[model samples]
Target: MPLCRLAGAGALTLLLLSSTVYAQSSTATGVSRAANPALSANVLYLVGKATRHDALDEPDERHAADADEHGAESPGARVQEFELRMTSFVDPHVKADLTLATHGVSETELEEAFVTTVGLPSNLALKAGKFLGSFGKHNPLHTHRYPFIERPMAHETLFGEEGLNEVGAEVSWLAPTDWYTEIVAGVYNGDNPALFSGEAEEDVAFLGRVRSLVDLNDATTFEVGASGLTGRHEELSARSNVVGADATLKWLPLEAQRHKALTLQIEYLRGDVGGATRHGGQVVARVRVTRRWWVQGSGDWLAGDDPTVRRVRGLIAYVPTEFQALRLQYGATFSGDEDTDHRVALQYNFTIGSHPAHAY
Candidate 1:
């Protein structure tokens, strides 16, 4: 995305982000405004990826013919990629987000197109369109929020590349609390697994969390939550019911009883299910190595009988300013069947347009 988009969407994201320096100006007539409301809304995004599969580990019996995460089976295949996302808001509480990209980094087809945000009341916010699912907090967060460039494999596998979005409605609320606590739940059609994620069904889904980290006095704070989806598809359906839970702890070394500053952190996630049961947990560590440099590492262990999936990646990122970032990383996988492959990638991101402020 472009710098122009970042500045525009900054406000759209305001409710989702920790308070910023720009917040201000309340009227007795009953309305609030930013000291600087925002100029024009615009967006531009670009990304490319190149990967080599020296050996995609394939166990003796795990069908190589089955389309996997990459949707490929042949060896020595190299994958390249591209993406562009742009959105603009006409009103403070309403906006449109559109994403266009290739199926393996090429112009094979359109990737994502969705519209979001219509604030109704203290406990109601609505979204309707085809986009990424918000099952886990991480699924809906932007690329900028993450300490590393890539999301954990657990996320990639469960949500797929698009992060599990479909034609649906989502509702969120601010629960009464001394600290920040949020509840978000959604209902939609499962994609067509054979071609898409499946189709909509008779069932609905829910994801809820009790959080308090925003502006907390404690340098270290915590959160615990659960997310699950269960739907029954009629005849000839490939429905996979799921249920899960997650917990996080942020141990910021530097305390600022009064401010927002860089902090080192670690987090973990675990989930239990019937279809993809014992999907496992992950460990993440991140550090702001310098004013302009950041380092992060993450590891995962799959718990099911499946061996084709285990992953770890290390990353280094550069932040010239808050609006943009450049990153490089090394990703390795232990798919029980495919080779323990390795990958190298480059990513450049510019936050665009008025959208929302939730971080990854």
Candidate 2:
């Protein structure tokens, strides 16, 4: 069968199966609808134009890794991403979530499939399966949830398009402190081509993170986090280490929490791969102008082994409801001595079914 037809058929089958289960569970007297998992789908569509048609095809190492990840660089309209998610509690003590994703007619991929423990002793939790690691704020976010049309140049260059997703087991602890604090650690099979390759049986990756949150006042809050990861390199047959730090400050007036707010976030990352070092960071600011309007801006910078790269972006968004949004964004990039490149994008996002709220 043709690839497009096969993908369509699979999607239809999944929809039908979920509908059938929902109907049966709802009508059956002894069956509890709550026993069924909650299902949701999110779709993103983008129309874009760029000054440099071959920017992604550039021979520069900085742009090579981003060739296949972003549809915005192609100068056309496309379904940027389609995602289907299912979440449910397996029992009183455990919860499971699965997310399947596809990009612009590409084959479906398992974005995340993990099970987490609910109530463990000493305020501890355990999670196992394929998941996005808690490396930095941006690495774990889904594309649909991104504040901008595309990821930062630093993240794209460091973690590839998908970020640090891997099959692993993680444990987290809620520390006893006056302020909110959490520590997380994990182990994974070193398989991500960008950072690691599990060629040998002993090749594995380790991750650690610490996060803390504090309320600055009645309407403001501050959060800080640090993350580190170590793994085996593929070509060099040696070990690599990546470290990151992030900070965020949010201000929301008690009287106008929904209509007015401001958020500032910053993150920096450094990696030592085979004795070579690269470092980068991004700063973003978002402001809520009204109940249904938002404006945001960000700056990204990277330096070290690769040529220095810098980008500035701005966006305006209209969110009529929680389920749908429309946005327009513009960006300019300067890489080393190359001519500046400019791009513009319009995006529409929508969701259906019972989706859970995003994390703070």
Candidate 3:
């Protein structure tokens, strides 16, 4: 069957299963409705314009084309994405999560469907099924959770539009240390055309990461992480290796945690493909101005093998409540031998039902 149909059927089945669970839990003695999966929907609407339409195209043109074919409007105004998410414990020892997403009015797609072990011995955990890989900090964020209007240029250039999401299994261990520390390893089907595309059983991609966190003071904390991946590169017809490092510093005053805060994040990535090396990175700073207002700025750069690309962006956001937000952003991109592109965007985001908190 077609992929869209299959995804739709899977979503329907999950919805029915949730309903059945709710009915059973409501009727059973001493059982709470919480036994049913938590369901949530998120929507993002965008209205924006760019100096050059070609430069404004999403990194994955194929997926954008699918949205266009489904009668989505031109780039200036459209529903950026609509996502339905379900999360719940499958039993005492396992948990499941599913995310179905549609871009514009495009066909629904299964973005993620994964199961994770709830408890294990020795601070170890296991996860399986199709999910986003725990790559650098930025690669794991969902669209609505992005601090800026769009992804950094470096990330889009290396990981395509969707980042490193794939069918995979992962194991993670939390160390018994004073500060928070974790080690993770995973293997995935090497099928991302932009970077990896091996088809054989043995031609899989491997990833490893180590992350640690420390509290600098009463109101400050710091986190650092390093990640490495090796896989078969289809375009180069050879093996490729990518390594990344990231750091984040944040401050939130105890007495004014809601009204004031600051965060600084930096990430660097280096990739070796076919004897050539490329380097990319981004720096971002964000400040909470008031209880419901925020300001953010970021710079991104990429170099090696191709013309260097740089981007700068700034935005201000007003989040009236936990469920809705409005933001206006301006960005400029410069590339060697190409005309600079300036863009402005206004985005509206809203969510309904029970939504999980994002990672810190």
Prediction 2 TM-score vs. true: 0.87
Tens-digit lDDT string for candidate 3 (170-218): 9999999999999999999976655675355556899999999999998
Q: In what order do the candidates fall by lDDT, top score first? A: 2, 3, 1
The predictions' CA RMSDs to the true structure, in order, are 13.1, 9.2, 10.1
Kindly list the per-residue Cα lDDT of model 1 for residues 1-360, writing each as its tens digit.
Answer: 699898789866875553443343354334554333333221223242325443332221222343354434333322333345665674787777666654343334344556567778786667777666666556665444555555565554445444556666767777777777777777666562311335544444444434334544456666656666655443344345544455556554564321333443333344333334445546666666666777777776555556536678788877786556677777787766655667765666655444444432
Question: Mind giving the per-residue lDDT tens digits that candidate 2 earns over 1-360?
Answer: 699999999999999988887677546547675578999999999898888765432323554545556543576889989999999999899999999998776757999999999989999999999998989899989888998988776677567656788888999999999999999999998777667743456678999999999999999999999999999897787788999999999999999977998999999999877787888889999999999999999998878876888889999999998899999999898888888889888999999999568666
Instruction: Looking at model 2, report the run of 10 residues with the lowest lDDT sum.
Output: 55-64
Q: Candidate 1: where are CA atoms >4 Å away?
A: 1-84, 90-93, 102-105, 108-119, 142-150, 192-197, 200-220, 233-239, 251-278, 335-340, 346-360
What is the alpha-carbon lDDT for the whole of candidate 3? Answer: 0.84
**Candidate 2 Cα errors over 4 Å, as ranges:** 1-34, 54-72, 198-200
CA lDDT scores, all candidates in order: 0.53, 0.85, 0.84
Candidate 1 lowest-lDDT run of ten? 37-46
- Cα displacement (angstroms), candidate 3, residue 327, comes to 0.9
TM-score-superior candidate, 1 or 3? 3
Arrange candidates, best TM-score first.
2, 3, 1
